[model samples]
Target: MSPIEAPTIEPVSPERLAEASVWIAKLHGDARGRAIEEGLRRWLQAHPENARAFELATEVWDDSEQLRSVVPFRPLRHVEHRPRWGAMATALACMLALVIVGVFWLQNVGVVATAVGEQRQLVLEDGTRVFLNTDTRIVVKYDKEARRVELRRGEALFNVAKRHDWPFIVTAGDRQVKALGTSFVVRKDVERLAVTLVEGSVLVSPVLPTLPEQIQPTIDAPGSIEQTPVTTALEARKGAGEFKLAAGQRLTFDAGAVTKLDTPSIEKTTAWRRGQVILDDTPLQAAVIEMNRYNEAKLIVADPDAAALPINGLFQAGDSAHFANAVAQAYGLVVIERGNEIVLSGKPIQ
Candidate 1:
């Protein structure tokens, strides 16, 4: 009967949120429909909080999902051999961006991944398969009209199942990668987002701030981003996000640029999943991080100059002590572990 602690509320799980989305969408934009919701309804009501909560939700949806790429539900549309299709619309209202992404929402959706130093694989109800790299999580939130996932951290290899109605969308940090029909790899670190298209197309866009007043009355549907399109998706994705990738394309995005490299070989880039960090002239700092992932013994490079020095070779991870010794030997340096840090210097400490 009293006001609830609204702001202090922990965020709802995507699946639960998706269920609420279905309730709001089915309400058909009316007060009576809301009155009939779980709260206003009779003893048939399943959850007592559904009424007031659904009310606040309707406002959120109108302010968020009413004008954008809202679609009704279909499953696994992104990985189907064929293309996925959707009906999207935009409308300008007052000083707000009335963005609505209609979906055939599912009741439960979440993305999950393993903890640090752990790798995992998951299959969604739509049949899409996702391989989460070490310390990664994928969320799946579905509705009667749509399915989506939020990649929370680390990396993932996606083998999307086919669905024409419910396309699979992965929101990773500030970037949104849409898998319309594809198998691809996406890695997200605090500083960067890199994507490689293995077998299909994906639209990788940066998140942009919404300028409510900038909404035009025209049906300004942005272009469809695909994997093979050679346009400057990077520029198109600017402000909000950057770039896209088609099958076989490899793109690495930093804060400034999206570099489209040569076609990719999955086996080469993801060889770490097989237990080794494969480097082709990679930086020393990066190699050290890889070793740290699996090693308890610290590797501290006392000489900043030595760390920047370029080196290339395939070394077994278990032999980091040997590796450090080799690096020191090659650079005419010394390796020593004092306390928690291992120092590699140009002079022998022993």
Candidate 2:
């Protein structure tokens, strides 16, 4: 049976919806983002449905950005179940993407992304600066009311222009970070998340009413597997937490409350920012981990004390082989590579 001529979701005003979509794209990728953009350019020169779809897609993108921007992100109540910067689930926003699109079907769209190892820099309407790191994706939300952003995966640094009433927030994992005129870093990793402060102060903590156990994810993109929801490690953020970082301090913690550790050193802490790792008498194992960031594979310390052998110098992030060579020469150790793992010892393993 022919798909009935569905009650078409009447296209909203071109300018208004288009404007709204722009805001949406700022926070989330839209139908017309890459696909639609290419499609639309082709449509304008070729046929009309392409143009119609592109136009409708445009409205969706613009409004999504606009609506969120208008609503603005706020610091969620301290619940502690929030994921840190490096370890947020990549599936949250994708689920909602289809919902937003379906609801506004025959609607508009907006936004952009960077590939793995790619960095993106954006300037918000209020002149705030956002820097994205490796495989990072973000959409800027702007509206008549407020400004906000949705971070999907990877890491980002926010240099915000603080406004007292309209606070700026970064949403990652299950937590919300409120920065009212500050600079901070948020990193999301597989097993952990972190929020680091570079300048000004940020209120880094958990969100209330935690993410329930047994998360059943929705597939938003093709060929992507949904994430299985996991429970927070600890109860509502407990322990002595709440980091008010100064110029060169950073805070890390799971759901068990904030753990403030002095950044090893300026050189060590900010190494990724400069694309360089300068270790100063750090353990071989620790150094190995840092070097592995530039590549894939687990660099294992064969001997417990093998890593205890401290060596220091500058190395690139994720350059495991070169770093291994450097480690061998500097600390009199042998390197062994097996599959995706690297091992260290005084003599190469046979």
Candidate 3:
């Protein structure tokens, strides 16, 4: 009789192979204990294929020191029998896949940020120019389907190179502005989001559920209607009360409602791009807030009466001293410079 043939072994899966690579990396680290050994033993005993996958991964890691060198494995501390192996393995597998695909890992995502009183311009891979305003941060992600930018904080102006097939979308403060071949500015503040269209058109929609209630329009708000005529004016497809904006239009969204301002001054709204801040009769408090965005030295209106004073003029961005002096001269407010703060107070009654 022929010798009894051993049971056929199934091939290991790529996922398992990746997981094994992670375990091998961990074992090479400083962590060692009976719990770790027992956990690994259980994993190996769970399936015959697990052992084979681990062996293959180990052999590959041993054979190529260069491949092993690519993985930046951190020293995990005091981790008992948890399934953290899956996460580590997935990371290792991804690194190896990046090597095999001839793609640098960092190339997938890009970040642009500006410090206070600073601005920058970036030309994206799609020939779109993005101008980041002071104290702004943006994450750019380009994929096969679309070019997406997340306005994580502050403001940015996007000059999109039209690609109808690859729509450019900007997400800011619970709102998404989808555009094609348009120039638009997205500003995200602590309590509100503003989108202004310079040219072309864009569809503005709320990112509900994903966004918290603090920033979204509530049902009880007067302007949270079922529809708006602005959508029709822009000739855009509407859904979920999404507002549409054409060139020279601006949409401001707060917790109360979304309001559209028609024919807004494109130059004044976008003056920061030219290192200027143009305020057309803006309230003093509001102007101070705007000025603080561009400068490390802050402007504080200690007097509520002084805070409500109207401000109108063009001032260079980041020129807090000049702005404070101008405000003092214009409104009879006293400007007191203390440390890094410029305090505006009502003048003494004469």
Candidate 4:
């Protein structure tokens, strides 16, 4: 059976729209406060247009897919008495204008970012679920023909929903990883891009100079113009060295070349998802770097010998103090607490 079409909504007045925008922001901002909730309830009950306008504005906000870009609505500051309707209405109008502009901006570009010691899960308009790790940033662009994501920094895991006609591709640095109906993780660093496939398959290849023009949609003044459908399979195999990675396999790209292909332990590679950092004979320096990603206080290996020590353990993410203490006891190193920095140095041999 065909899906029923949703009825078209008439345009709401600017004043009403503005009020609705402010109400939505306040409600979202102070969801647990009873005062705001009761006030909003009374406001909605006072006028029929209030409810309709709020519903319309909310629908637009939900559909925009870029709520992060919008300026959050802040409650009005305390005043001597109740403000006049004219003043309220004027404030609402300005907010509504900003909402309109934000909606348009989000239509073309959407960005998601996470700070240190933070993780985020987001479902895209295409139904793909993305799990972003600490200090991660990604830009998503979806159009009629293709769905694309650029990993600007850090790491993310993609659980892509199947849409054979629309290819799912993630680009980081000079490499592109293409997948369909698969789950994979992409980590971007200063000099390398790593693609690890947990289930299904993916093609990891170098990004050609001309590839961007072929994949990105043509944009005009108002909106994007539909371009030719990107052929994922063909593009993966053309003009570059491509490595087909199966489940449990990983492909690392460095310096515009395929550096390595290995089958790493999936649990170890994805340990961050479970809020733990697992180290299996990892170098002390590298382990310190991993732990520091999750904490504000930095960990520093003060000696070359201490930095080269082998580390193996499973510890909660951001437990730098515990890690430092453990390492000091095990290796007989001195742990110097210097403000926010934890420095590990080898004990002097007597």
| Clash totals, every prediction | 51, 43, 0, 0
- Model 1 lDDT tens row, 1-350: 23322122233234443455555444443332445565435522655555434443455445333222211112112232422212111112211122112111222555465655555545455656676666677677765555578887788887887776667777877777777667888888777777888886777765555434333112112443333332243335443333555567777767666544557667666654454455555566676776565455667767666666555555544346755765676557787877756667774322
Per-residue lDDT tens digits for candidate 4, residues 228-323, read 234575445443455667789877767667467788999889888766788888888999999999998999998887776778777778788878
List candidate 4 stretches off by more than 4 Å.
Answer: 1-108, 209-240, 256-258, 348-350
Q: How far is candidate 2 from the true structure (C-alpha RMSD, Å)?
A: 17.7
**Against the unseen true structure, what C-alpha lDDT does each candidate score?**
0.55, 0.53, 0.69, 0.71
Candidate achieving the largest TM-score: 4
> Can you write out model 3's per-residue Cα lDDT over 170-210, one digit (the tens) per residue?
98866798888999999998878889989888878765444
Q: Best candidate, lDDT-wise?
A: 4
Error of 3 at 147 (Å): 0.6
Clashes of 3: 0
Candidate 2 per-residue C-alpha lDDT over 199-315 given as tens digits, one digit per residue, 9 for 90 to 100:
776665455454344431222343222222333443334322234455666656555544445554644555555445677777667776655655666677777767576656666
Clashing pairs in 4: none
Ranking by lDDT: 4, 3, 1, 2
Quote the positional error of residue 85 for candidate 2 in Å: 38
Query: Model 2 — TM-score against the truth?
Result: 0.51
Q: Give me the overall lDDT of model 1.
A: 0.55
Q: Judge candidate 4 at residue 55 and give its lDDT.
A: 71
